[model samples]
Target: MWDHCPLMLMRKNFVSFHVNLVFFQVEDAQGREATIQRLADSIAGPFVYSVMTLSAITFGFWYYFGSHIFPDVLLNDIAGSEGDPLLLSLKLAVDVLVVSCPCALGLATPTAILVGTSLGARQGLLIRGGDVLERLASVDHVMLDKTGTLTEGKPAVSAIMSLACEELEILQIAAAVEKTASHPIAHAIISKAESLNLSIPVTRGQLAEPGSGTMAEVNGLLVAVGKLKWVQERFQQKTDLSDLTTLEQSVMHKSLQDSQSSNHSTTVVFVGREGEGVIGAISISDKLREDAECTIRSLQHKGIETILLSGDREEAVATLAKTVGIKDKFVNASLTPQQKSAAISGLQALGHRVAMVGDGINDAPSLALADVGIALQVEGQETAASNAASIVLLGNRLSQVLDALDLARATMAKVHQNLSWAVAYNVVAIPIAAGVLLPNSDFAMTPSLSGIQELSGYGTQKVTSVDLVKLEMTDFDVILGMDWLYSAMPQSTAEIELSSFSSQMSLF
Candidate 1:
């Protein structure tokens, strides 16, 4: 019996602590692996290795050929006793080593990433590191999770079709039963009741079935609020509910046809009691983010393929895809977490680099599997979705994702520019240190040649860092200057309320 009930077994065996400890250890390992993976993917690591290899080759080549190729340059500079061919060769090799400075290569990617992420943060986009930016720049496909990525994730009561009682009365009973439930649908019903200032009856002996519905005793009667099938299963065990089932089919059909008013996808929850039959049905809908369509179109315009994946009903998912301008072939519906991960893997198998965007726990696995995972920020510390993601959007708007993509591309372009300059500097300076340009170059000592190369590397470092800072500072000044120009515009009340509510949730 204890084995069947894990909670009971935990209390009896004292093994729960060990289990939890092991679970945490796995989580820690995953975090460390993700960090290490990002560091390995960064541009600086490869540049360092390349520069070191080239430096070694430069040393060997100059050491062997200094006497033959630069006989004029070396003989003129040799001192009395230490001026042998071998010593002069050694001196040229040392100059070559010092001139091939890796300082510029070391600082190139990291500085650009720092400036880019700081700018991104100011605009509510959180770039995890240079690796994520690098991935973002090359991603050709984007997999968007429907619920919180495209839709608001907040369900609202769209319609109330009451059969056996007044709509208000049915809502009061349903809200009372759902008050103790933590589901999003439950919260929507409760919020509707509160907004109407309805007085709810007391509830007792409440029980909630995850992903299905909730049941509770209200006004001395067992009131259930859930899917039609779950309610029918519970009610049919005690009494016949054929009439209620027929009524539910009618209500559901009606709700589906009324998609114009409800918009997007809507879920119907049956409210009823045993023996008394079905009383009413509540139609709840999740609204699409106001900018979702525009954002999708923008991504499409950039030639990036956009795909929608959701666990929602197929019809609803199709409707959303159509509304957002995504092709029918690219929309996938009714996928489990494992299926979502498989879809990402399949895309990658086809040679497409995928970026997964989501904001829920169900998305965590797919987020981890994608080449780049971007979590839409909800008001919280850190979600499992965010932990698995390489990029996170701190703002609620879908448009912010576009901003992040643009910033990442720009940052990468800057990184390439810095690296090109660094490589070119080494190419030209190493040969000079090897005495190729020594006949025409006005360098009296080996120290002077190395000093010029070191100064050039230091100058490149200062220029790269300073240029980014100036660019970001200039953007800030422009925004501050234009604040008054936009201040007189009226704001949407709905958007204002939603933004404030989102901000408040983030604080906690």
Candidate 2:
């Protein structure tokens, strides 16, 4: 927690003479709902109050004076009995004040948002605010990064092409230099070296180039492990592998031995030494998520354009795109974070709302730039993607994206319903309370009746239709949600549940 963020105690729990307290505050939060409600209150508050006062005065004068002037038309048993004109006027004026409540207009949105956000929190969805929810509901194009998103983010070493160098030596140096990198491919190389029981050397002054690779000093020698072009530039050598020597005895280099059965999806990186030039190439492969294709299908079925963004080989990205049902034209490969952000901006410029989803540092810029950013939560890793994103999925399930879309849609629906009802009630209730129906139907609203109806609307909003329903227990759960869960946007597409982080402006 930052020094500025002081926790405001909400509640405390007891266990074995120990106290565990949970502290969270969502009031006065700055988001779509809060902004809209404040705006609505500023204008609607005075407007309703002024209108009520004016209407009361108008009705009061008409009853007190007009009753005597036109007894046959005004003096009726509908509202007030034949009594002192001042007393009769006072009762009707008070009725006008009671009927014109600011709740239906002001309270509608905030209340709905509160319920929606709280429900999302309990379900493991940390939605940032009503603004993120509104934007998520409007996203027509979903841009998903390949690693840790479309794929499992668990790459494994498949082949190593050493040029006149021992395979184990190449792997050892590659793993040693790549040890400082956090990328899944780096993990793959290091894990392979460890499985082979190779003694890995420590490196210092590591420089990581996003979407390219890493370079470091290993035992006084500057070695580079990444893309061929980048590694060649770091080694000051030529980027050419066509003039490589024969490798006829290797079984792991099946792509070279039997070209017919080669895996095209494998990502290959060059390993180079300070003076040895390009020494070898390490090939790695990560499998696509089991739900990747289905999740893409679901988005497509709901009329969302699923686009693939990756910093991998074009062929690999295109192949994954084909498998996941995203069109070839929508696939962006070998792109850095800036390029990814440009891709999002381009789509946004074209008036298409884009939602970027990823789980790496490279995806952070695009995630924050998109209309809504969705990030997957890796249990142990504190990812930059999670920090920048507006929505974070706790589990490694692709379908959670759709679940989030569903939640956004559902939450907005509740907001619209509340606002609509509030507007309609004000429109009808105010007119009737002003004695608009007294002339023809002999019906007039009383102060007590106006108060009852206004209070009923609020009472009805307190409970959900499925409130207090029983469900079987599966696992232990504890949750806290504050005022959130509201949006006024049109939600006709898919939505999901997500929780937000620092963007929430809880003053505690």
Candidate 3:
């Protein structure tokens, strides 16, 4: 009950300045359609209207001056003015105003974005907004977090090596130390012990070093389980364990190397005790997601550069990159969460548009920093990485990254097409309304014809009605106008609800 207090709420939120900084940054950036529409509404709209209004005044003055100087030139049969300059000028001014249709210019970008985002929702992508789609279309580099983004985040313990203690003894003690951690590697150790019917001892003074390892007191003995160097540094500092020999260190290094060079790409975690020093190594293997390779290949085929960035060791990062066809120069290993964000920032500083893919909470920083952040959902394991991401794949499929990219490019293509149509419509209509051929042939676009032509742009669809709602849904919600329908809800249920609503309306 004490946990429900308001002061306790700040702990979960504002975990760091970076987290809040990323989440609040949505207001500063606008999507492709939004940018275009903003320019149209704020600047282009007024500018074009002013230009048309001034053109009418200028054309009226020119015709009025011509009526006195060369009356024959001002006489146009279209308006039936009988050489009356005021009537002709007023008629032509109205024609120009009607012909300057700004509807298409406003509607072009937004319509495409709405359809694209809605389609993405149907395909298991919960895109934040149309701006994300625009960013996805522009991504040149894709930075991938190895453990969860590329490989199956779930790892299983395959082998264990020991120097001073038995394998089972090291395993049990390691599990006790790891039970405090929520990491996939920790889960692997704890799960392995559970599978072997070994009960984990209740640990005291359990401590975690994020991205490095964990420590705890098991059976009144201090134990450290994490990276080899991390475990060695802590244990070797203790005077009681100072006598740990150089021969044992060399053997551990050899075993660590051997563990890395296995047929399967594996990560090695060291187990160290207070008195015995570096006692053993645990080799854990995480298989790649089934679609990881194909997705990377497709992105590469589309000329997108792919990079592997992770907190894992260089050997582990390299092995995963090689398996996925990412080049060696593109791989960076042993990065903390902050370093991952810094690497992405460096790439972006070099003018490369980088997209980050991650699945763990540690990935939130980089995911928030990238030009586009794509997060893959992990079943039974959810992280706030999605909260920082621009796109979330709820199906947990890596191939959906490519699906997002393709859809973005295609949607942008549609926007360009719509813009082209708007420009072509304006280009042809304006000159005709301005009465360019009135002197000789009396061929001019009348006010009625101009109104009809302008209506042609907006009559097809109420494009502005496409509400670009700020949707932050984990599951799909298809917003069709004012009605909200869950994509997961059955069709019959929706129909029944709609029928019930209609009956209520009839009774009213």
Q: Output the number of the lDDT-best candidate.
A: 3
Poorest stretch of ten by lDDT in candidate 1: 27-36
Please give, for residues 1-508, the per-residue lDDT of candidate 1 as tens digits: 4657545333443234433432343223223222323443464567556655655665565556645665565555632254566655566656766777666766566656655665665454556666677788889999998877888878877777777779888889999999977555778899999999999899899997644568999888898988666665666543346666565566567766756654456767888786765678887788888888999999999999999988665767898899889999999986777888999999899998899999877788998999989988653335678778877765556777787788778777777787778777877877676656655663433856687667657565545543543332223224334333123223422234345545644543
- Span of ten consecutive residues with least summed lDDT in model 2: 16-25
In the range 386-444, model 2's lDDT, one tens digit per residue, is 77988776555677788778767766666667666767777787777766666577676
Global fold similarity of model 1 (TM-score): 0.69
State the displacement of the C-alpha of residue 307, model 1, in Å, after optimal TM-score superposition: 2.1
Backbone N/Cα/C clashes per model:
0, 20, 1
- Cα displacement (angstroms), candidate 1, residue 308, comes to 2.2
Q: Which digits, one per residue and each the tens of the lDDT, describe model 3 over residues 1-508? A: 5857565434443224432332333222224344555665565468476757756674666466645654665556653656667767776777777877677777777666656665565556667776777778888999899887788777878777777868898899999998867778888899999999998899999988777888999999899998767888877543234334443344345544655444345777878888877787787778778788999998999999999988887877897889889999999988888888889989989999999999877888888999999898753235788878888876677887887887777766666677777777777777667766666665777788887777766533223223222223223323222112232222322233335445644542
- Give the Cα-based TM-score of candidate 2 against the true structure: 0.81
Candidate 2's displacement at residue 31, Å, is 7.2
In the order shown, what is each candidate's alpha-carbon RMSD?
A: 11.4, 8.9, 8.2
Give me the displacement of residue 158 in model 2, in angstroms.
2.1
lDDT of 1: 0.69
lDDT of each prediction vs. the true structure? 0.69, 0.69, 0.71
